[model samples]
Target chain A: DDEVITHAHGAGGGQMTELVDAVAVSQFADAAADVGLAALDDGSVQPIDDDHSVVVTTDSHVVTPLFFRGGDIGRLAVSGTVNDLAMMGATEPLALTSSLIIEAGTPQTTVERVTESMREACEEAGATVTTGDTKVMGSGEMDTLAINTTGVAVVPKGGHVPDAGLSVGDRLIVSGTVGDHGISLLSEREGFDFGGDLESDVQPVNDLVRAAMDAGEVTAMKDPTRGGLATVLNEMASKADVGIDVEERSVPVSGPVSSAGEVLGIEPFDVACEGVVVMGVASEDAADVLDALRDNPKGEDAAIVGEVVDDHTGQVVLDTGFGRRYLSPPEGEQLPRIC
Target chain B: DDEVITHAHGAGGGQMTELVDAVAVSQFADAAADVGLAALDDGSVQPIDDDHSVVVTTDSHVVTPLFFRGGDIGRLAVSGTVNDLAMMGATEPLALTSSLIIEAGTPQTTVERVTESMREACEEAGATVTTGDTKVMGSGEMDTLAINTTGVAVVPKGGHVPDAGLSVGDRLIVSGTVGDHGISLLSEREGFDFGGDLESDVQPVNDLVRAAMDAGEVTAMKDPTRGGLATVLNEMASKADVGIDVEERSVPVSGPVSSAGEVLGIEPFDVACEGVVVMGVASEDAADVLDALRDNPKGEDAAIVGEVVDDHTGQVVLDTGFGRRYLSPPEGEQLPRIC
Candidate 1:
């Protein structure tokens, strides 16, 4: 490992994995959790009783610019944790804790805007901000603001989904278009206007996921946030010790996002999508799940983009109609503070 | 409100109270919690079942220098949340989530040291760091590091304590000496040689609190952190709509801390004490609680500081033998980034 931390170490890539394992997992090896630090899943699960278990996840949002076209840091802070809980099959969060660290000179209006955004997002997700802490740092000691939210949800014991539960014949379903968030933020930050259509798809997707789960069995689930579709597929394949075969053309990408990615020399599939979920559904119920997801407005572009396979275990193969190649996890962050 | 946030808005005093009430409490007005954002207590409680309730609390640590005398940011981060849960009568935390945001150029060794300290603190508190998130900001965009920790504990329904549960005849007891943490850090930062005895009292006091709870009936509880003992006393008095009368000489102040505070022109009651707890116990149980606290090494300096009164509602009076005065909440941050 390098002597000093770098941007890549927090980019949700191979480097970040190594860093987390070495620094956190190794130190917290004795955590008495069913799916704890060692699992590196969307959240940790602790059985509270014979019939119920508690699910928890935390994320610190340090997104630059604070506000973008579609959402602000406050919305991102709440949705990020909510989606993580939803990934573990805990769709309805019991509560969310918000801790804000603001720079000394940040405008009071900015704080109000962020709080209002968080409230609206909580309303949208059917969750509440129950408790929070606030602190302000010296002017140059911190950036504009950073919001850390921790979400708690309870599910029936043995009922929560895991990212490594995929079977050989499972089908992979994507909730919506890929790479909209990362691409949109990149375009906006670089002063490249791809018109109003190129805006972040940063909204809570727990309701969309609830619909999908209600329709059929979701064998494995994950949201493509920091590392996008390619990274998530690779993670699922490797974790389950199975192979994934994806039809590249089946993956939906908005026209504006596709154009913007090309102009920025970035791959839509290699970026992030805040309001998206990639799930491995049982083969028998794939069609019903797809239909259920498509019925929701947030998942109107839902598609069956891939399938779990036995051959080429621990790898993700992308079929582009003319050829096939193994997709890899992203190496480093493409756009810093795009969350 | 000022156009921009200043240091006073986060000093855990009058200004900070106004900011939190205006921004967070107003936005999260609909939180369906037993003790939610509106109460502004140490944590929030949600009933999980007929016999059990869930307690949750969060704190974001942005201390300067990262490493202080007796503790670093790591110990403070874990202990802060753990103690908050303990103050709510949830002595045994099931799990804690850590979210670290570091500057791009910080040394990995610094992170490892902090993680190690956190592990030790968790062990002392009988808790676990079950899940976490890490992110890096651009160099110069942030200080060395900031840690946000959220704790979750389950207790019997209606068993938790609130800061507003004080009664007219209740007795107030402090677990240890005051002004150690804040004064130590101030001296260290200003390059004053205060000697090793003046170091921070920053260890987790959950065990000590547990002993007291087992020995007596505690009506109200609070940890003196940012705005210190005076702030906690005032908050308790105002929230419970009662008065508090304190014998100034009875409040324990170690020789070193007393001397340092005198030289620095700061009142011990107005500064932070990370490892101390001020509890309002039934008058009959005051002696037993004090004895139980004194049995623990961390609480060896325990003393009966005050008692609740019916007169002067929502105010705290200090009896100095020669004269009497009202103890006011610290006006602004005495020191920035002191955690």
Candidate 2:
């Protein structure tokens, strides 16, 4: 572990995982003792009954400029937690708890606006904020607002996906456009007027995940939040001891978003996506999974972006039109506090 | 509602309640729509099986100094969430999730120390941190560190203490010394050293709460956190529509802790407590409950400090040696970020 934590350590990039593994995860002595935390999926699932298990996931949102073009921290808090559970193969989202730490002097209208957005997002995800706590700090003691959301989802026994379930020859799919959220928020935070139709793609993806699960067997699943698509695939490859190969042409990226990244000097794969899921499925069922994802609004642009391979075990490779290049995880906080 | 948020709104005092009701709770359109959030206890509980229910509580700890004499944020985060579940009558703490929002440049040693404390506290409470998330903000974007923990616990069917379960003939009990946590943190933050032994009473109280439940029927239960004892009693009275009469002499306060509160110009009742529980038990079972509590080390100083009465409905009356005086809930911000 580094002597001091850097901004990159929290950037959901390669350093972020290293910090977590070294500082946070290392301290938990029993995390790997059959408590279901060893998988390190977006969420953790524990058995609550013989026939069902409860999925629990939490995320603290310190996103700057609480409000963006498409969503606010309120919506991000709920959607992120819901998506975490969905990544764990939770089919039915149940109850959620919200905790807010607001900086003094924040406008009351902003709180209302954000909370309304939260309720709308919860409604969309088929969940409710059953309990919540709120605290306000001195003006300079905090940012505008920080929200933490914890969600509980109930799924049938033994029906959830594991992060380490990827196998050689498994197909990898990108739910939709990548890097929309990161690019949109970075533009807003830095006062960059792309002056185009760029908005965050932050939303609940439980429906899309449900559709994918119903279509075929999903061996592994993840939501590309802080680390973007590249980091998540790298995590899957590292955790499952497999290799990933992606066609540069097949990875879906909107023209405007790609252009924004190019102008910002940030790679599209190194940013974040608040409303996307990357999945690993059996190669034989890839076509069916893509068809099912395409049928949903959230996954209308879903594509089979890559596949698991055995050649470069525990590494990711990108295939260009003429050559191949290794895809390495971003080093440090490429985009700080984007989520 | 005030146009701007204030520090009092997060102080766990009367103003905090008002803000929560006006902003956060009001925006939750369906919290009371049969989702099990309407009870408004320490935590919201939902049934997981016909024979059991799961209790979930989330809290954000933003204490000024990350480390204190008796405990640090890590212990506070784990204990606080565990205590919330215990107050809800959850006897068996199951799993917990920790989310950390760290400022860039925080020392890795500090991170390791805090997480180690968290693990120790979890082990004491018989719970595990099964899952977690970490986010790092820019150096100036956040305070030193903020930790949020959400805990899940399972309780047998019909074995919880409801906030609205108080009756006219019930006796109120204080588990142990109050104001230790609030006063200790305040003195440290303000650079006051009485030169005597003073430390925060921050520890896991699942055992104390479990013992109280085993002793007798706990009509109502709550931990005197941000709002203190008087505030918690007032909440119980308001929610249950009963009167509470507290005996000033019977309330247990340590010599140094009480003296510290007196010097700081803060009421013993307006501050916070990290490891105490207030219970309303039936009058006939009060003796047995006290005996059972006294049998445990954590509850050795337990006392019947008050009682549920018929007069002064929805209010609290403090009985001094000379006369009786009305005890009102604190108005605002007794000690900012004193979690």
Candidate 3:
């Protein structure tokens, strides 16, 4: 048929751009589209409606095994999707669907488990898995379970969404502890013995998001999936074109997760969070949002981690407990294995 | 960690069902969600407002070599999504997300092409790829290009769904020539030399569907995907529990596709169709709908090949050109292969 995908297309950056523009767009050109190929194509098209701004983001999870330490492909699939919807101000995601690429030899069990996870997640999110499809490949063409899910959630009538929500003196809040999901997965991958209990922090945060929203006019929300808390906040700051000042000591991190992080020589800030949420809100609403978040079962560990200031331009600076500052966007490309 | 997925999981249907019902659900379970999980852990608890209903559907495209003769994984991904949405009475698909299981050694170019294809498709359908995820499997865990896509299409207000309006005198109408997509794919799959200008019927049917909707009071609409033409009509008949009679000669078939089918020992009716649609309507509106369909680019080959009768319960009797009658539904299982 046409050319198949090259490995670098999965790299999450520049080369990915070329592949989309050259082959993907050319082969699937749509005559009815205002721009034959839209933003994801050669030319960018502005959002149709300006008043109701749309939130956009993309993420990929390449955990070594399709199944994981505490969960399998299905759970991971749903968690990744619900987390994306929550990051935006949308509520009650109405629908979601997933496409599957199965290895020729993949067990039927894996496919069902993943769909089951999606169904369960949809039911939880008040959405439906109204449409779906399955396809198989020759052996070695795909991982046993690789799923891609995209969906939508309705923004409430009074909801306001914009990247510039952050400003001087605004507050930064975290729904709960971070790095647990990443740590748990890493431990399982590295075969670290957990004395008592360790689990991935993967969970949907709609409840916590809704709670946080009720607590205050949230400036922005994000699920730190790939580059973790630091990167997410950095992206938000860059897009909002604001500076972020944070107290690393105040950012909640579980003892086990922190210990695991130290041993692995990886910062918890870049660790993946299955359910954790990073929130930006008005300084006045910080305490209230934390309270509301803690009240929710999923956000019992929620806390006010830091504040947003106008000092540094789009950079996130961490104030260590000893009154020292550490620059933390990530020194280089985080290895793919950790997430 | 936990085993992602292995060969045992993809076994027979019974095992597949159990796997779907168990682990996958638990993984995506939300806090309030019942056992099943999405991100929140507790279910996504939101009540409905009572005015609208959401339409849900899922599709998976696993083409050979992750690309094809006239298209590639990217084109198939988008077309697959759009077509599934049209199968329902939805007007424009609102969003699309894909879950990918990419093999580690696969080139990144391939992944980008597929994602770009997804992005383009969303634009054409007036939908957004608001969220998506990618997971890479260890080397040898999968074939290079398996992709699963799930989408949501908002069904317009008014009971625009198939209510089995199927009456004693309703006519069965097919939107266009069949077996093109199937035969083309089959030819490519096997090393058979096929001739003629045969293109896969993988175009989206939003325009064609709109034409049909505007044409008349429709009884039903079904897209022949996995099961193909014969099984689709049979399903409509079985659901209505009414007898469906199809005029064999009147059913349209592309000459080359038919020729290829004969040579390959494939039943044209059972082969997959990427763009064709099967519609049932009141006998009176049949002509108008057929006319409207023929006017669209996708429906130039539309045909009215059958009608509903009072007997046969759930059986579909096909009128062979030579006066022989054949019962078709398929013996035990569908193609088990979704690619």
Candidate 4:
């Protein structure tokens, strides 16, 4: 294969999958743990004890324009890892380790600002940054900085969500508005002037997720990040071996994101959402989960947007109210560093 | 202070301290776990249960020339983290998380080779790469690749070693030859032709560390990596508040490394050794520990080169047969990415 890594390969799309499958995943297939590399979920789950397990997740944030409207890379680095743990049904996060590769000559003020934001995010998520590593590369060896956070969270052994736990009768609920993060970054990159309350939805969603988990049992959860809502749903479908029937109208999108998508020739559903979580729950408990999520500030716009079906396993179908269509895996990175 | 991050900041030396103290250390000062940010040891120890605690460590490997004579970044990434765990007296490692950032257009072959090496390293260390994250930057955003590995290990509550555990009468023993890793990378960068059996000592030292640990209780342990033996010994002296008296002739340095050091104008004591360990042990048990370490292939050159002294606390003095002198903290990174 003449495959090469590109911006699209980092875009959390099909090409990214190809790169991972061809180069990275198989190497770790044989070294299985409680949740090894073979499991393509948001995080890795390791059994710490017979009755409890530790949910570990790591993400490297390379968002361009380190400082964005709603948040900065520090906040994203913390919330990103925390949210991954939450997606694995961890309500209590333990410790986080940050590995920072910084570009030399970067202003000290920028690093301080980012660290302050990260501190705040960690406080919000009720976790501590206990351990970290920092390396400075010569100027141009890197853009500004890239942070990789590895978080550990403890969960009840049998009471956590699984990526492949979705059932035929499960209802899919989206925590909040999608595409805000993607559009915000895209606009920032293109230097767009049409900005009306378009900010990256980049904040810790553990509190809101906990509320939903308390309201009802969650079969599975995924935070739509680089790949967007469509890609995440497809992943859930494939992992669970079930069909995801998404109602296009029910998928929440803010007015700014909708307008920006139209201007950028992109679909609102295909843009990333940093704080949004797509969760699958029992059909009978979906309403309670939605209600619980809506009560939390972070999940105010929560909605039941889809359902798991028996037909078309490993695929996602969109119901456009006018007509139905198949939602294919993202071809390439529509927006890099969407976070 | 109009301080800025420089290549020296990442060199694990004096400037690195200024940067870490000003930017990184303060942020994590109050976030204390079993072995938190305040202790600049190899890994952070977290108290999970009353009987056993979890040891966690993370390191970012930005070694240049990804493919080296002895090992690649993948192996270094895994072995580095696992070694950190072993330094904390973790005979059994639990899990590892790898975060990789690759430059766009990097050959898939390179990625495969590195990943394969990482898998082998994991196997050798008896740990699993259970979780990982991948990100690709544009062609110029990175210089090939950088890997960050965060590892987890379980240790008996009271059986672990501490950075400040050295006692006044404790002897310092270094496992294997020093400066191999540093000299190799430096020679490669300087294009030195003095290549007589010069290879990086960048293999896992867990077996040697374990052998020594089983032989006797270790007071303190450190892998002489970024800033090499002098920096790590200085850290111990400061932390343990004990003076270190090192015998210059007793410090083991391979012939190739000694030649390379002389040519590069670098001190053997200051050059990093990726696979070597410096340990503080009771004088009575030093011989037993040395015997055990020498039995292992990784520690065949084990030597007791120093001892903790009650005088001149927080300092390291080198006795060069006729006279003694101070070994100050490294001024800067002599060779960058000399992992």
Top-TM-score candidate index: 1
After superposition, candidate 3 runs with Cα above 4 Å error = A1-69, A98-128, A158-164, A322-326, A331-339, B1-52, B98-139, B163-165, B330-338
Write one digit per residue (lDDT tens) for candidate 2, span B152-248. 8767767667777899989999999989998988888889987847888998988988787787888999999988998899999999988999999
Candidates' TM-scores? 0.99, 0.97, 0.82, 0.98
Cα misplacement distance, residue A111 of candidate 3 (Å):
5.0
| Residue range B37-57, candidate 1, lDDT tens digits | 899999999987788889999
Against the true structure, what is model 2's DockQ? 0.68
lDDT of each: 0.92, 0.84, 0.62, 0.84
lDDT of 2 at A95: 75
TM-score of chain A of each: 0.98, 0.96, 0.82, 0.96
Give a tens-digit lDDT track for model 3, residues A144-197.
Answer: 445555544445433634434677777888888887777777777788866646
Instruction: State the lDDT of candidate 3 residue by residue for B1-339, as single tens digits.
Output: 233333223321233334444544343433221111232110112222333334445555666646666566666766776665565566576545454656666666667666675666556666654334454455665556555555444343343455244778888889988877777777776766676466677767777888897888677777776557876777677767898888888899988888888988877888678788888888889999999999987799999999899988777888887775755744433343434
Model 1 docking grade: medium
Candidate 1, B-chain TM? 0.98
Model 1 per-residue lDDT tens digits across residues A135-216? 9999998999999999999899997999999999999999999999899888888998877798788888999988999999
What share of the reference contacts survives in each candidate? Answer: 0.79, 0.73, 0.32, 0.72
